[model samples]
Target: MPRWRSRTRAERRLAAEQQGHRGEALAGLLLQMKFYRLRARRFKTPVGEIDLIAEKRGAIIFVEVKSRGHQGSEAEALGAVNSARIVRAAQYWLARHPAESGKDMRFDVIFLAPGRWPRHLINAFSAS
Candidate 1:
């Protein structure tokens, strides 16, 4: 078993939070390299929150960042529940930014694991 498997709930929470931060950082850097303009980070709405929002070439991307010490859980982290939340949050975001409402939107997921490069999945899910 992994060391985290033995950790308490609170410990695991803290570790997860730290991992999320690191993952977001890496994702942001990757987006920057791709020349995407970051519009938001940790965007919050009444329904849910989006980890990152970036725009490039008239398209806006809503990104979900997930980090785990084990790569196996990456798929689990990007499950339906998470995608639904991101869609809801993105809706809220678009409502608040009416000027950008006409732009094309895409949902993306960035998975991070220890000692591995961050993997960005574009158009990973959809609101529909």
Candidate 2:
């Protein structure tokens, strides 16, 4: 169960919004690893949010996917992968999964563009 805050109708609405966010995160992550199988999602942490966590080639990858409503500039979509955010998310992900601390970890990003194929950036950036 993901960290969802919902107790009343209004809370339910917020939960819905959070759930939607989680879904988008999952979608972006899946788009990246669609060739592989889904392992898990909504990886938690005190630093930031990790949209999706999947394993491929025996490597545990932490993916931070950002999808924006199409913008005029192509760079706008790619800009979503900020270094600070990626580091925070990766920190959170690694902190939660100690077993994966020693495994090959990668930070990736997937940009969902309008009327265009999703752009997958593999090992696009590193926390170091």
Q: Per-residue alpha-carbon lDDT of model 1 for 1-128, expressed as tens digits?
A: 65555788999899888878888988999999989999999998999989999999999999988877786666677773377778888999999999999999999988887778888889998888
Global lDDT of each model? 0.88, 0.66
Shift of residue 19 alpha carbon in model 1, Å: 1.3
lDDT of 2 at 86: 62
Best by lDDT: 1
What TM-score does prediction 1 earn? 0.87
Best by TM-score: 1
TM-score of 2: 0.67
Quote the RMSD, in angstroms, for model 2.
Answer: 8.1
Residue 92 miss distance in model 1 (angstroms): 0.4
Pull out the clashing pairs in model 1: none
In angstroms, give how far residue 114 of model 2 lies from its true place: 2.3
For all candidates, what are the clash counts?
A: 0, 0
Residue 64, candidate 1: Cα error in Å is: 0.5
